[model samples]
Target chain A: MATTNDYLKGTKSVLPILTGLFPFGLIYGVSAVTSGIPKVQAIAMSFVVFAGAAQISIVNSFSSGISIITAVAIAGLINLRMAMYGASIADSIRSDRLLTRIFSSFLLTDQVYAVSITEKGKNMNTNIFKFYIGAALPIWLTWQAATIIGVFAGKTLPSWLSLEFAVPLTFLALLGPFLVKSHFAVSALTAGIVMVLTRNVPYNAGFFIAVLSGITAGFLIKNRKGDR
Target chain B: MNTSHLWAVIILSGIATFIIRFFFIQIKQAPLSGKVKELFSFIPPAVLSALVFGSVFENGLSSLTPRNPYLWASILAGITAVTSKNVLLTISTGMIFIWGWNYLY
Candidate 1:
């Protein structure tokens, strides 16, 4: 069972991450509306889809020449790693009831998973499921509120805001942490260059190519270092 | 796509994503080797870089020019992210620079 302290700790731990999400959510809301996604659905997608990167990219896939199947594939591919997080934390919740697992799985996300996994290392026998919930619920609420606000605030904002830069900047912030790791750095560089070169590929196949090449480069580099 | 079609896309894709999240958690046997599991770890960085690079350099060589404050904003953002390691700090730095650049020039 999760005590009040654990839940509070989870909430307090997530405060910094919450501040970061506000802009991303606002940007997603603003962008999704203009990307041919209906305003209402855009708000709905926040809580429904709940994955920011996948949600933004899926909305991008809606452009002409990209098939619906392709859109669906993009969503699946982007989120495949969620299962990895699911598996990583599975040991902690092995004995929980099905309903508990289902609810927990619904809220599983990168930030929540990161906090829960890090906490796991510090304390044994912690109720991670409750911690996960405490962390996830606030994120969910913040995202939805921001997205809704963005949807309504769409187009009314000043033209000088350059809202277009918000997403990339946010992503850059996320990618920045991995730069110190040689293998990860090389992987990011490989993907970045590949993406730029393949930008014009039909149906945005560049995304798949870039990601694959990055992972391959990172894996190979890591393997070589291990062998030597 | 019509509203209905878009709705279908949203609901279907949402379901597919949820299934992926639920698969390993719901099942008892979500086994993997050390090597394969490590590969999964590379996914986020790779994906984040792809998205960021593709967006920042969206216009190919055109975006590399000095007028593109996004490029500059990204540099500041990258530095803030690594040094501060605070997501909010990095975002604020980037947002402030890009927005400020827009008005100043």
Candidate 2:
């Protein structure tokens, strides 16, 4: 059973990931502003879209003169990975009501999913749904605030500060923990190589290719080990 | 971008994202097969690596060279993260190294 403390615990568990995400939010806000997106639209993008990578992609599309439909399509494609996340975590949240599921799905970004799944493994006795909400709300609120702050601070920040590096740095922090096992290490290396190889591919198709091939390699390697 | 176009992109993309996230949750009857289970287990690592590589190597294949501070900083950050498992340490170390590299060269 989940007590109020469990919910608070969930919020606490998410803090580490949120710390890494803080810079990412700032960069996204700065990107939106510098990319010539209107301030209101950029802030609204955070409220409405709520996904960092996709929001960046949208801003890139705008600056590059890509059509609005194509921009939206790219955003949709970028977020297709969230479906994989939903599929993987479906069982953990199967007990949630439709309304809870509907609302919570809106909060299913990469960071939140990673922490919540980790928490689920560590504490199976807690209410996963309530715990998820407790974690999600803080991240949602922080991201929105960070974007607004970035919009205001974007112009003044120096170029050499290299705040953009924080995005990849945050991913490194998340990726490091996943290297606990050999197959996971293999997956990360293979995916990273594939992503680099296909970097010239347009419209983020390389991302999809890298993810698909990496997962395939990991699966095959795991099965090969199992058979041995 | 105009206001209507901006709103359209935001709302449409938002709806698409919501649908993707909600689709599998609504369909709970089918259990994942063994192969699918293995595949899903790798998604987190695979997806994150893809994202990190994409950013760290912003110039694509050319970024593997010695000139890129991002490459070196990421290497350092990865080591710190794997060893310490601390978020702040990883980001701060990476940022500090990049800032120093930029300052020096």
Per-residue lDDT for A23-142 in model 1, tens only?
A: 778888876776557788998788678998888766666644366777777677778889898888887755568887778888888999999999899877678767778898998889
The local distance difference test score of each candidate is 0.81, 0.80
Superposed model 1: Cα runs more than 4 Å off: A1-9, A34-36, A62-65, B1-5, B61-63
Quote the chain B TM-score of every prediction: 0.87, 0.74
In model 2, what is the error at residue B4, expressed in angstroms?
A: 8.3
lDDT measured at residue A6 in model 2 versus the true structure, 0 to 100: 67
Backbone clashes under 3 angstroms, per model = 0, 0
DockQ of 1: 0.59
Q: Which ranges in model 2 have alpha carbons more than 4 Å from their true place?
A: A1-24, A34-37, A52-100, A109-135, A201-205, B1-9, B28-30
Candidate 2 residue A145 C-alpha distance from true site, Å:
2.2
